[model samples]
Target chain A: MKFSDFICSKAIRHELSAPDKEGVIRELTGALVAAGEIAEEDLESIVGAILKREELGSTGIGRGVAVPHTKHPSVEKLVGTVGVCADGIDFTALDGENVELFFLLVSPPDRPGDHLRALENISRQLRDDMFCKFLKQAKSAEDIQTLLDEADGDQFGP
Target chain B: MNPSEANKTVVVKNPKGLHLRPAGVLAQLAAAYDSEITLTKDGLTVDARSILDLLTLVATQGSELTVAASGSDAQQAVEALSHFIANDESDEEE
Candidate 1:
């Protein structure tokens, strides 16, 4: 349920180059593939599934965060990666704000419980304004990972 | 401050508890009333108006939730929210 439990450091990126929603998804998924978390052959399918989920409703839950997720058969277990966009992308957020932080999750179709727990864990950490501010200000992947480690350690109280 | 307050304890009936979709429905309903509404479980209280806060509760199936409202329409708000939690049918799609 902790961010560190499912998020691999290899998949974390800082200041992603993509400027739009589709581009962001592709970039983040590509990161996962490069890290060997996802098969390169399944990359396009995963991105397509996430985009289709967005059609139902943007995962951009506002406050500069977007949790774009999908249930894919290719993924045996729940996996996710974090990306920071220096220039925000238009996500059509519920609050009508651009999203700067992206947490893209891909989980097996059978694990709804795990998916919900991950979402809860991510949102719980995000509720702290200081955590969000520090994540946005992170200059490197290591910096972002360190912040997540501290947050998971209860350094930022509930 | 208005002193009229109402509270109800309801057991979550949905198989998935208050996940995103159901929590979103609860938040939307809670936002319709002017009352200050909160849902508490396991000693953690969260504003009912925020989908994010509600999701943080992580209420699984059969979990007990205490819905509380304070304001002019406190009674109505609590009743509606408790009913919604106990009989939510919107999250059937998974």
Candidate 2:
């Protein structure tokens, strides 16, 4: 469940321009669409599904991060993208903090295990404060991907 | 277990298991008490207060988990957490 296993590198956004939660989600999903990881036609439906998930409860797990996700029939497997909103977006999170790091995931409805493992892996890696800091400071998509690559390699101390 | 520590094993009931919503709710509930609590599945244990740690449990439906707490509120904490884990399946989809 390494980040590389599911995250669409080309879809990564180091500086998100969205000003709110829905905007950020749409932004990241659009990136996935642009990267060819998800179908262009599926964008709105996927965004709607992810927003519906948010209505159940905010995916903002706190520590200035949110892992917005949904299971959709549109994706053949798991596909995810990262977006950094350096300014933060209000997510109504459990910790009552705005979110800056967004990890949005869309996966096939049938693959619950992969979804869970991806969540677990993301949580495990994000637990490292240095990783979050570096991710927040990433200045470009390539820089963000490099950090993710290093995270996958266990370069950041846990 | 000491008198100050409480533990109970529970079987997950949510058909979707402990996905983000359920895990998030459980973590929020666990945060309500002063006791240090943990949820264990198989051999892996996580801080009950952390959604991140709870996610790592990846406790799918039918998974058995142990709820353990230590503090003055241990008994009540264990009771509430186990009850939530065993009976709460309201996260089922439309």
Candidate 3:
């Protein structure tokens, strides 16, 4: 699925104030809640679920990117957001490098296919070094949304 | 000395196909060898060492993947990865 399909502009954050992994997740999850995508009562449980997934293994896939995701009962459909942390955070990445890009996904427990597709789309776009470079430099939510649009249009090359 | 190259086509046997978690395991297995490994499906080839690249393949159940490897350990890498893809049963979770 296309990132623009589920990654709402209101959920995009250019500067993640959190300096660590947990805080980063909290900040991003909080963004989704604030945007009315997820209920406030479910916030703690959703963040906890994502954190438990982290315990299985850090979602940090290296190359300054992390896809922290979980299949939750709180959401009836797939919901996600993109956050950039210019200063980077130690996510215990497989590559042992700090992560600057975060793509947090929360999907219903029944839609495994959607979750995988989302991850696939995000990774596919982030694989482009130029896209990652521009995403890292984005200073506003509008800039990040614009980049996603351009990347989805194949402006970055195959 | 030049390294040997090996290629084999294997069917994804996991009920869920080569999804994210299995792809991660496959990538980790490929990374342990010295060979330059890749998987090709539908004319798209991706580095076997990269989980992200592997995920893009979206090799759903029953899909065929051509596993190719070239290096001193080419034969072993291809054989092991092919076998893992074709017969592994530890794909339930994690």
Q: Which sections of candidate 2 miss by over 4 Å?
A: B1-3, B91-94
For each candidate, what TM-score against the reference?
0.91, 0.95, 0.92
Tens-digit lDDT string for candidate 1 (A16-102): 998789999999999999999899999999999899888777788878999888888998899999999978899987779999999
After superposition, candidate 1 runs with Cα above 4 Å error: B1-3, B91-94
Model 2 lDDT per residue over A31-116, tens place: 99999998899889989998988888788989999998898887889999999988888998878999989999998876878888
What is candidate 3's CA lDDT for residue A154?
85
Q: Rank by TM-score, descending?
A: 2, 3, 1
- Considering lDDT, which of the candidate structures 2 and 3 is the better prediction for this target? 2
**Model with the higher TM-score, candidate 1 or 3:** 3
DockQ of each: 0.52, 0.58, 0.49
Quick one: RMSD of model 3? 1.9
Task: Give lDDT tens digits, candidate 3, residues A1-158.
Answer: 89777896898999999978999999999999999999999999999988988887777887899988887888988999999999999999888999999999998876766877787788788889999999999999999999999988888847
| Clash totals in order | 0, 0, 0
Q: Candidate 3 — which residues are off by over 4 angstroms?
A: B88-94
**Pairs that collide, model 1:** none
Which fraction of the native contacts appears in each prediction? 0.43, 0.57, 0.30
Ten-residue segment with the worst summed lDDT in candidate 2 chain A? A107-116
In model 2, state the lDDT of residue B70: 92
